[model samples]
Target chain A: MPVQLFGPVQVSDTVEIPERSGTAFTLEQGDTLIVIDPRGEQVADLLAFNAEDVAEIISSGRTFDYAETIYLTTGHELYSNRSRPMLGIIEDTVGRHDFLLTPCSYDTFHHFYPKLQPHRGCFGNLAAALEPYGIAPDMVPTAFNCFMNVPVDGATGKLRVLPPISKAGDHIAFRAHMDLIIGLTACSAPDSNGGTFKPIHYRIERG
Target chain B: MPVQLFGPVQVSDTVEIPERSGTAFTLEQGDTLIVIDPRGEQVADLLAFNAEDVAEIISSGRTFDYAETIYLTTGHELYSNRSRPMLGIIEDTVGRHDFLLTPCSYDTFHHFYPKLQPHRGCFGNLAAALEPYGIAPDMVPTAFNCFMNVPVDGATGKLRVLPPISKAGDHIAFRAHMDLIIGLTACSAPDSNGGTFKPIHYRIERG
Candidate 1:
């Protein structure tokens, strides 16, 4: 479960995401989503959703149009909500950035990290981000995970969290289509797979 | 219940706090004890652990020096667990921003908001911002409300939430002395009186 990089992105861009974007690689306008894998040794858990097309985000081997060559830079728009762009790409370090595949919150953390009881995560962030925009928690959609190494049996496509290749501070940015809102939770579960936590940093900027 | 705007602050620009700072504002270095009244019209719903020392942040406010002021154009490091700073002002939007508030949760909204259903808000995004920093729910410290316009009883000097003046997109930002972890729930508190919430942008930058 891995994905290659190719894009038009910049640093300090805004990002917006649909409530139901599956854990996959996707984009929108006026939104900045950064997967800062400290030292480029982690994976970013990403997701995407479109109005007509459910969630079409590519989890591993994300297509960045190698032919396009230009990474998402200031003003690149991500689309959603029925093909409307959700966020814009305003910054990037080119292919050097890795979309590590990481998602937070599972029952395992409850079993292992009991001291850290009631650990909440991103699934809830979406609800909070959407409130101002009129999006309610009932509208929260399933997400497409990006940078995640969800290995399917090759015969069966299944989601799985693998070791990351993203480093610290390596992030992504984008904008919103119709004021997309999202939530954030710094991974407290050391390893989400059964319950482990790896320190990560999520930063944002308005380019 | 309100303060006027002053001049642009730079790295080490000292400011003085009148008695208003004594009852309204606060500052800390070792722990994450902060709040904000985004409405800018309500008094900050602040509850302090070291409540007895309300006058200290005021004294510190007297000659509150702006040690550094970099336009968070891009890649501006505000504050983090690494190389912590004691006091940092939010040099956002010409150095005028709100960094003292909490996202009231749905429960709070229901309890405070009259007849209104729970709504979406900033709390989720605030939580998301903490994940990468390795701070978790357990790390969240008791927060103090800030920037709100609270009414002091004529003789008792008690604080109460009043109507707000904050416009859409008006925000508050701050730099933490310690690695701070925050949770958000866009305060739709029926009882929490403040201005209406319009969409706004939240950012973190490094100098």
Candidate 2:
């Protein structure tokens, strides 16, 4: 199981990704971004890209492939497209995560609530967050789902969605390897975290 | 088995996603993106996001969940995270496709070639293609793998990667349900397409 190590620190910046919205910020190399599931059930779409080039970003597939493990917690390094270390998990309060699933998007809600057109989702939230940086919504890529619950049936690989194991104030921290543009989205999926959507809080700490 | 249906049409756009690289293009609601494995062994990372909202992108988990199948081919509607139809598979010359696995990334290759250090992967390719639009590499989500073979051991759900069954010129086509920014990456994994990497050709056609 994953355990938290970094609990107290001097924070440089703290902000909340409003329910169903997204946030973007910058973190210098060696800095750490702490993603907090304030309510214990909400999921956060955690994404990062090289400050100079967006093409070299963190890849969940590679993270799992290199780790040779399905679950991630402290000590795991999130790798970029070029295999460069992007972030290292220095602390994690919740060991269970859903790197296997993509963040919920408008189309995901439409699958169940077609009549509720333009439903909010993590995909939209991230796009909105990146817009100020001149990134078009269509160019936004997939995300690394943090705090999401997706349990795989070890016997069959069948996935079962569940509520997050985090508690209020539970957080995870990553030490950046390069200057990064961090994008985050507060997941709004009704099925996430026990059929309710919640907000997320985060902070960046630099030495 | 999935079968091809649409054929012999004027190409609106024809381009090659070179081996170890990625390509990004646009397709209107009625337009179709035809991915061609020129040498019949290359795997393509197929991804798409709403032209209006990048967050409304494709999700392999939802696609398989809604389709109720692990394999994808003709007749399957590539659903977005919201469960709305994004692309409809009108044709598939090669019936076997992988939706259960995430796209290859730097970490994925490092597992086998730690010394290779900077092994190229589909994740980086896609991130590059979206660079012009300001979408960072970390934002490139999981992908729909086309043509690469991944045989599932039924009882165990153990995935065994294999060479593509498609011959040269084998292809797949998807009719967009909405305006879309489609991304494609020619997988460069050493084990892809029978131990050799190849290029992929694609074209968009409008009714």
Candidate 3:
């Protein structure tokens, strides 16, 4: 079992994103959002938008450009397309994540997993969950994939999706820089989750 | 003067995209779109969308994932969000290109070039040019930056944007797999164009 560190002082609520599903909620500034992979090797896709304006969505390019590294972990800030900070990684146990890939969609299923039943992947899940917040599908940008182990070959710049190294109970936490609308998911892509579907747990904590 | 090779057999009208501006046009299947940097070191941001459905836009993630390399060039196919091939590179004089970075925007200037006059940048330029086609700004995805030189550090995966090495008259040609709406720009970001801006020229041809 993985040990949880730097977690919330008081337990408010833990929301379970069932296997292959997603949810959306609001997190106020200074509050920490803890996303937990209850079972080992599960990947969670995360997105954030400014509460004041949905047009200001999280930008992977801005984050990668400012951070100066693709390996984003503690102390890194996620920036919006408008160049404003949205979230900061306050604490993290599993450091490996993916900001290079877009959320998988129904087309992803059709292209990669034709042998399996067609299903709306994480993109669709995020779109549906965020719909209530007036965020459209096209508005969804590249996601901050927590615990997704995608390795890019240095010499060739080739990418490979590998099983996540995050063990059971491992988690990553972020503190909001502004009032934000967040869409998160227990990823549905088989390749991303090491061929197993699992639940993701998260909670919002306030001081 | 750079030698143009494997160009269209017959002559066609060449459209000049003024410095710091953009334009949109439709290319039918099997037709080729050739984008040229009239005076080199200029970066032209390019975007493609399925003419049938605007929602099925070009996807850098899918293209990179399928091509297995971030350095996309000759013979590579650019894929859409739905995993369909949108265009294929038939010729490229300057092999270096960028698919990882989002189009530079007003916010990008605000963040990086605060002292410089605030320009809409390529993102805004593309949005404006594509608006008549019903493509909202939010629908724009990461652009395929032609002639842009962005090298990623092998050990750290850090990205650095350097001035394009393309010389005068350097160009790239892409054959459309499906009818596509193309948005091309003479990049507005100073850093991207090596502290100066120049015109981008393009012409569509049917064999």
Candidate 4:
């Protein structure tokens, strides 16, 4: 059963991603992808791959090196492994996001939540959603975690996952610089999503 | 021709990795691998994989999430994709190392050093060395950068690659928690090595 705690699903341009699940879709160059955290505190793990070549996937290292900042928001361009801009953030209602960690997986569950029932996490969801496009599990890289709060300790370089500050209906919008295959998930990790799961929403607007 | 600026190749247990190159070798469980910086300001990229199942590779995210700190040093354990401990740092001469950035590559050269002749960086070197072990390029993840100095800004979370503080003969030692295949490199990126490149040395000791 889909848990839709926010509101009645609007039938317009929005597409709802049920709690703890993921989906994949295509976005042509110049299109804008607006991802919404409909119920606040939910995290969306996002990934992008070149439509023409899967090898040219979004790269956190390249983006961080070039952008010079890990706190990516409006105006920040996401770079690919080939160092080409793939997506540019055009709008962000919630300014904080995380790119330092990889998508959580079954392994993550076993390691972090041994007492809870293990679930194949965002990694598994992305792999399954991307497999049809010729992407294998090993090919997946670190994701742009929307609405995820990971704070780094200045003195020790330590990191902590905290609840997101976004409110209901807060969304981030990205413009595709090139044709891309996007994998998006409503993150399954309890800590990442503030110990509760909720649906995510997104819409594509032609440029 | 290999540049030997450090000293006469001590033919004891040390294996010399010529400048800008990499090598892959096997280590049994409980074995210790000591990586040495024979020259000052040189960076070495190190990766590990479970010999029994190559799919279970070293995971920076898992390690960081579990260890809680990015400044990994002596007594820190490197975790695998499966959430199991793969390597434990038993000794560290230099306290600072980078696990935040991915291995630099040809794509890196094209992006950052477009003015100079583009050389495939550590990523390519690791790919070539690990290919024999059935590890593909995409299979590679962020490496434990030995002696590579990357400082993240506390205020903005920006990252900068700086010259290593490690002087000659500085080394870090890791004990294998499982039988493993290791890919190690003397990094080729100019900025990573402080505008120059040098050989890296390592030795294996049975537990």
Candidate topping DockQ: 3
Score every model by TM-score: 0.30, 0.66, 0.87, 0.88
CA shift of A171, model 3, Å: 1.7
Candidate 4, CAPRI quality class derived from DockQ: acceptable
- Worst lDDT run of 10 residues, candidate 2 chain A, spans A1-10
The chain A TM-scores for the candidates, taken one by one, are 0.47, 0.89, 0.94, 0.94
TM-score of the second chain, each candidate in turn, equals 0.40, 0.91, 0.95, 0.93
lDDT of 2 by residue, B99-194 (tens): 655667666776765766566577777777877766666566667889877665433334567898989999999998999888898887877668
Q: Tens-digit lDDT track for model 1 on B130-180?
A: 445443322222122333332323222122444544443344445545333
Candidate 4 DockQ vs. native: 0.44
* Candidates ranked, most accurate by DockQ first: 3, 4, 2, 1
The digit string of per-residue lDDT tens for model 4 on A1-207 reads 253566433223789998889999999898889999998999999999999989888877678867877789999999987668999999999999998788889887887899989998999999999999999887777899999998887668888899998999999999999999999999999999889999999988776
Better of 3 and 4 by lDDT: 4
Location of the lowest summed lDDT over 10 successive residues in candidate 1 chain B: B58-67
The DockQ values of the predictions, listed in order, are: 0.01, 0.19, 0.45, 0.44
lDDT of 2 by residue, A1-207 (tens): 232366544455468777878888888998888899988888888878788887676665556446655567789888775667899989999877766565667666776557665565777777778777666654444466787776655434456668888899999998989999888988877776677778899988764
> Per-residue error at A53 for model 2, in Å?
4.3
Candidates sorted by lDDT, descending order? 4, 3, 2, 1
What's the C-alpha lDDT at position B139 in model 1? 25
TM-score leaderboard ranking: 4, 3, 2, 1
